[model samples]
Target chain A: MRIEEHPILDFKRGREIYFYYNGKKIKAYEGETIAAALYAAGIKTLSKSLRLHRPRGFFCGIGKCSSCLMKVDGIPNVRTCITMVREGMVVEDNDMELPDKEYEGCELRKKAVDVVVVGGGPAGMNAAIEASKYARTLLIDENPRLGGQLIKQTHKFFGSRRQRAGTRGIEIAKELEREVMERGVEVLLNTSVIGYYKRSHHFLAAADKINRIVYEIEAKKIIFATGAQENMLVFEGNDLPGVYGAGGVQTLMNVYGVKPGNVGLIIGAGNVGLILAYQLLQAGVGVACIVEAMPKIGGYFVHAAKIRRCGIPIYTRHSIKRAYGDGKVEGAIIGELDENWNFVEGSEKDIKCDFICLAVGLTPSIRLIAQTGAEISFINEAGGWVALHNEYMETTKEGIYVAGDLANIEEASTAMIEGKIAGLHAAHSIKPIDDFERKIKEYMEELEIFRQGYFGERPKKAKEKILEGYYEKMGERRSS
Target chain B: MKRWEREGVAEIEDIRLPTKEQLQKGVAIIECIQEIPCNPCVDACPFNAISMENINALPIVDFEKCVGCGKCIEVCPGLAIFVVKAKGEKATVMLPYEFIPLPKEGQMVKAINREGKEICEAVVKKVRKGKTPVVTIELPAEYAMEARHIKVKAEE
Candidate 1:
């Protein structure tokens, strides 16, 4: 049960209802989605991972990831995190069989457009708005909403007045979306850009839907803002059905209004893991513990303090040994690690938990960009594979541009600025390159301010290194 | 009226006294302990009684022109506040209580201090329980000097 009154934002929870998990009846709420009820009822481990068969629960409750994916009414792979439950809707777990016919690709329209954006997140939204100044832009998103991970963000953002500091991320997303639509940018929801290819001066986007329409956009430039995918960690019995990505848990609790677990254990100390821990408590679920292999917490101290005051312990230098259960996760074995990162003998601790949330890291979804045959590089600072691009986000391929997490994994604020540059450069192609240079300087300064505090060190350094290498590699090509 | 009387603030009832410092600050921090969500006291004051915007925002009391009318005390759902006056080694404390066998006027009772420790004997000057079952107990000068928060003793 949630606290009656909160010191911060007021929680206007909906009327209560009931649902069933594995044939056992459980109480939920009417307005809230299914995942919320399960968390409130102390149930976690919604399903297992596909390859590892690890128990996965809701981490990001925004439906961006498949951590909260479950079989609803005999439909597998349904994002139960965002799916609202109707009365008597049957929900099951521990199932990972693919559908009879897999979706080969999307039904694409062989039509031309001014520009095509591969994402509709913060970066994609800003890119569309900026590009609309010189071209008719098409913004595409995979989810039903445009916010992406912003929907699960209930905490106040830290930025200048222009970025709406002290305002919630979801509110910022709403404002950004409104600004984009007001600029007459065409926004397409529930549209996933499955592939990207460079042709002449434009990039063809193969999108997925009922009818796979391939949009052959005749753009002077294209911005690939496909974003990043969550990284998975492997362990013994990791293939259990009740583990999940950290982002998946956030989606389950905040969006679908369901609890991710009763006694939940989280791996990783990064912002994603810490934020999800707080969200789990807000959903009225007991966080058994937060496990991190690092010697210290990786997220902001304020975030750690928030959970610590609520009695959730942060176990440093600890790693999950294995998740044990039959078909579903019943418990997890956590052990201490030495300085050499080896498991210490006799230091193993057993925690009775149903769900383990993984927030290990993220890998850029650059498959489409790689398919474009653009010069690609493996940059660890970018967190994964990244297309070689100039400061203007223009790749080796003249008209191909990569923005947002596709180019580098950063916060949404930076991604929005990057999107703007990519969108503008893609519109005018040549003239906006100068404009892109000026915007990058301004954003670099703004980003410095965001990185002033102690918590900003690693990410700020990472961003600097990524930019430094990009400019270094470009040499005079960027000037050209 | 004799020692700690203020200039323009009216003491409509001798029980509820307004403090000199409160009069200077132009605000009164009324301590109401009512569990029910009632806002009559907020409405009863003519000079913007209290802000009732959220039904949850704590009430703000303006003391600049309160006049110590005691109308808010009469209307408060939870009889919590007591107008206090402290001066010259003495003080006046007004309290709200509902109990049978009310203390008689000028009767002496054990003066339990703020820490719930008995300090000295206190003389009750006035006791009023209207037909509404609401009672106001006025304690002596010394009781006001020490008492800030209060709870009544159960009669044996």
Candidate 2:
């Protein structure tokens, strides 16, 4: 089903179109993704698992997860979540059978730039905006449009006045996009950076998936603002078709106007989970309840209160044991957790719902930056393994910087500040700006204000540990 | 533990409620007890009634200077602030509401408390439309402090 009305967001759909799914004709819109159109038409099972043939639906709607990979237009493994639907296009489940077709040669392109920002989220856009002031900057993203995750956020942000605290995330994305365009920052969307080659200089091999072209980019500095991926939870029937990530549900409901399910069960009670619950209610969907393993709610008290006053129950110290259904999620088994983190005996209760959302946490997507020989270490407070970067947001390897979730998992406000710091420092290193030091100090001060709160304690400590490691590695390099 | 910590419902004693004299002249009640990294309410107040030592500190409202303009209600990202005023047997409570099919003027609705329980019937007095609409309701003075939200009855 599709959401017809919402309190906050307005879905401006494109012209209606028709497509084929598994040889059956399905209605779609011109701007709708294949996965979204299919979900809206009550087709949840997109693909099946390789080993056991388990059904899998849309999980991470940002094209990060492989749950929604389907064959489109004779291509074997196209990410349907990011590919827009065309009239009369044929989309089918990936059968792992290769099609016998001649391949066309991809056009090769080569260019050099002063700075290359590798993400289009809040961090990368800000980085490009700041870096382009002093250098020839280029921004790239793997999505069809810019604003990686911000495009789906419908709530206002929390920060100081300078960071646009009262502004909504979608509006902020538009502002950043306008700034990048006005500052003459080159933007390349629908492109994925495949590999990094340490030749005479650093060469980044990128592929334009839409245009069928390859670009060999040589840059003096690279800022990897590559965001993050949602973490999955393990349970019985967890890989079912209706089990979705919290961000994935947001993308479907807010971005594409597709209702995830009639009634949903949310796992984890962090900000993401709590916010998703509220957004679901706004879309006229029923929320069964929110279950958190922790004794207390992990999100803001205001967020909890907002939903609680609306008659939504929050079960603390509870965790989902299993999701059960024939081919999709029909319900879930939840149980209470004891003080020792063990499930209480006989506390299991069945909650009837059509879909389950995982909002457990996120890990930094460091595969691209890690391939560049940047030293990464495991820091529990920073979510998981993260690239070691100094106060300037530069990784151990010179000329390669990491910001946002790639550096650590934090709020978008802090990510933007980190991107600004990285961009300013990278540009100064190339062109020697006069106000570089002053601007860096100002950004660091803003970051300090954000990290001074109770919720910021863990991220503050994690960032300190990362900076300490960065300095130690630098000291060893100097001694050797 | 406080009720807000365990059940997500702020008890009257746990929050900074307005004094009887302050309630006579409509004062803002801030239910935000957590020390989050936010300070929009501080700048949203034109009378400078809301102040915080730092961005992370809890906001303290000066009832003596507050005029109950309801400006902070719209700016607060938490939607935790409310304005309550009592006049003899009746009182008016203003809250930030963001929902479809908003209650019309003079329409009867169910006034809900912090625990999501309907305490009493209330009549909608005024509705100021904006990004987050502010709905003012009139109810018994005794239930003014408890009512934080309103539920419109489904049309037949």
Candidate 3:
């Protein structure tokens, strides 16, 4: 099931190692996540669901989802997807395991940075790179690596020089990570930012999973590029072990080189779903069909065209009615959806499949920003609730800025552009730069050009509304 | 125009075809109809044959100065640029390819259209591999402007 070779990406060899899974020895490699090793070994049933006790596998391959949580080396609730494998590590499912013993409290540390950037994805990396030129910027990400989803994306980007068009995303991620490291941005990895305390000007509470050290940092300004979370479609047997997120499947197949499944069914036709379909075929996985509830395909036609030529069937106005299997997905039933978004009567058809993947949409991860008293509003067009920010991406709370999907759900190209804008703005707010206005204008012009395409029109309008709201609020504050 | 395009919901842009006069003059036909934010092709041309009024407008090809150098094909990231010329009964179509196990010179392959429909068999005349790989193939003059992709016969 492991992808020994790929056309685009080269998975170089690593030091061979061994780990114990339920007392059974399994071969692994150093620096590879425990979940990846298991998946490569064809162990998809990582854990079981909480109430129903149904088998659960890797979902959201990032640490955001707890589906891959397992007991590792006497530690409970270890995210196997994010946890690195070591020799002789004892791995067991932690879904039903009780605490064998209570460990001591996590170590604590305090420090201050000129600017602290949250969520080390494209947005955070750009923000850190820009802010570090003016101030001591500190970047923090939950994963051990700096690139968020960019690490998994192997497709070429779609924009001119400003968006790094023509460059594959995986290569771009490596370039960005190298630039961040070389530009002197202080990076803290394997640590998730959990809380923010504005009482002392700036307070960030970060928990490092590797060292079990909790960090408290005070900064003059901060940028939140925390990205978004995937959404699952509702259907019978949706929680089965074989059902996975579009990004989750990408991580399993692309990042770890593990085949997601022999046969699969994708639930959405958006860019995520469309891209996943093609990538699955590249990994030699047979996709039965893509079921989109919308009347038309939601992604770009060029993407759909590629899959069409590859002999994959896409069913528009259709929806997955149910997934049937003993414990994991064995087959699925799909039906057509009416205009009202309901399945039409007697339109159901059975499809022989082993995997059911969801690419419906994503919700912004706004827990920490909300904790900072940032004014967040629900905007469906912007992909659910996002933080309200000014043209400079400054949130309601002064000195705190929002960028990337945290501000609005978009892909890595625009997210990195927004990050550069917010980074420059936050840097100027912290310590004013002489070339601030020129840089902002240049970056904003490039951003405007990037948004001229049809796919970018909606996010462009949402940003206009956000700026208008900021100006209106500013006028009211001045009058008061 | 396609079905989804006629209904005004097409996400992919359609390419504007060149006139008969332009086709014979060795002018480039850029198959990018959308307002994408790309300007590499504009900068790639030394003759200034391609022009963009707006930063994100579809590139305009000047048939007189185009020269059919196919320089833009090397820089286009979307692999959307194609240069075609009709010479008697045969037509030379230069296309961008990125797949692995590339076709060699004098290789006979299936010529695919915009919709992935196989038009006919075409002979590979030249292969330019670099940051972008472009394969120039000679096909029937009737499929001069329609063939945009090459399918390796071995893959089938």
Candidate 4:
């Protein structure tokens, strides 16, 4: 199921190309990902689950989750969602990794920059753009293209004018990329950061999708806008072949114009879920309904209202029990949850559907930040274990900062603002800018606007506590 | 009210409406209550009537200086502002409308309330397809503030 007509986005009319999946011929566009090609060919079962040998489908199409891992040629564990398709490439489902054998034609190089920003989504881009103004900055992303989620976001954004309110995300992404390039920030696409060396402040990176050449980047300071990965719900047959993350479905449909399925069930009623539901409908997918475990809908009422008025039913206080199908998802079992969250007896009902999208939420990617010896604490209010940082977006460790979903699981707008703040902080620490305090105060105020009112009150207080915790920990270290 | 309750959000119930004297003085009512991160309304007013001190603070309007130009109505992204001019038993309500297949002039359409529920029918009078597109609908005086959205048809 692919979208033929869209109201806002004009999915580029790209030239078609041919690829090989399991040695069989599959046609795809030149710029499409392998997962998108296979999904468009009606191949949902990407690989077998690690345990039970059951089929596993796509989730977190951004390469965060291993559900979309597959063997390309002799390579195992290659993320198919971020891997671009080429002509006649053999794609198979299996385990693969950097081969144990001796290296062949591998290029190893090293370079240094004043600042390096990882994960070129909203955070990284904004970080690079802001920091490059004072220092030489290098921005890197694993995807072949930049703009992480913004590349797939087709809806208009919400924020003040400087935040690009009412502007579609893809357009905003292009604008950011333009500014980043114009500011002379070095950007490397299709490059993944492999590891970080705390002692040397060197980060190992790899590029060139299939056969990557490795390089080392030594940075005076580094910031991570790596973003977050989607969280999956556990249930009977939850690893079915047709299940995908709400963001994963958006990646397939909005980014590649390939709909996840003809009919689908969205499993969360939050902002991502509701937005995906509407985008799914816009992509010509018949959405059955939205299911939320919470007693009330979690997303903005304006967004929920758009779909409700458009005739999509939202079932609250209900959860999925199981997904059943012989080899692929054919339907789902849902039941009402009581006050204690246990399924009520005799409330099970079956919904016929081809796919289920999990929009439960996201868990931040804090591995790199923690590996750098930065202080990290598990804060559920901040969306899981996050690197403890001050209000300047500086982590406990010197010269290391965290921004975007990696620091907190907020969406794009906040990520953009945080990235700017972090980048400014890093740059100022190195080569101080003029009127730095005033500029920083302006940005902090800008950030506060997003973190205010009833919705933002929790994060506002949480941020205060995080800062307080950081100071206390530092105080303990100094006194000892 | 819940966050998504549609009505009662950006609570405009307590906004002070213009009295007959103030109405003759040409005042515009700022019903925005939610401290959302939007200020196009505050910036769009040319009469220096609307001001927001804090970024997240609700905008305040100086009724005496408000010329009722309805510039704020065109620029409000939330679609929360409205301009009311009382007629004998009817009033003209100017609102921001962005949907496609817009109602034609003199077209009788179903008028909806803040909750998006159809309450009555209204006649479309003016459609200003400008930088900030707006449509003026004439309805009963009681629905001056109630009618915020219009349903063109059951299927559109």
Total clashes for model 2: 0
Tens digits of per-residue lDDT for model 4, B1-156: 444442223334556677765664345666665555656666678988888886567788787778777887765644556777775678777876655556788988888765557878899998887534678888887877677677786243
Residue-by-residue lDDT tens digits, candidate 1, A372-428: 777777777778678877667788777778888787787776677778777877776
DockQ of each: 0.02, 0.75, 0.33, 0.20
Q: What local lDDT score does residue A188 receive in model 1, on the 0 to 100 scale?
A: 72
Candidate 3 lDDT over residue span A323-404, tens digit each: 9998788999999888898888999999999888999998888888998887878777788888888878888888899999
Clashing residue pairs, backbone N/CA/C < 3 A, model 2: none
Residues forming the 10-long window of minimal summed lDDT in candidate 4 chain A: A95-104
- Give the alpha-carbon lDDT of every model: 0.64, 0.89, 0.82, 0.79
Error of 4 at A82 (Å): 0.8
- Window of ten residues with lowest summed lDDT in model 1 chain A: A1-10
What digit string (tens of lDDT, one per residue) describes model 2 on residues A1-480? 888888788889999999999999999988889999999899999998899888889899888888888888888878899889999999988977774431357789998999999999999999999999999999999888888799888877777787887677888889999999999999998899989877766779998877888999999999999999999998899998889999999999999999999899999888899889989988989999999988888989998998898888899999999999999999999999998988899999999999999999998898899899999999989989999988889889988999998899999999999999999999998888987767888999999999999999999999999988888888853321
Q: What is the lDDT of residue A46 in candidate 2?
A: 91
Error of 1 at A344 (Å): 2.0
In candidate 1, position A236 carries an lDDT of: 87
Backbone Cα, N, C clashes tallied per candidate:
54, 0, 0, 3
Q: Where in model 1 is the C-alpha error above 4 Å?
A: A1-110, A208-215, A430-440, A451-475, B1-156
Badly placed stretches (over 4 Å) of model 2 are A98-103, A476-480, B154-156
Question: How many collisions between residues are there in candidate 1?
Answer: 54
RMSD of each: 14.2, 1.8, 3.1, 4.3
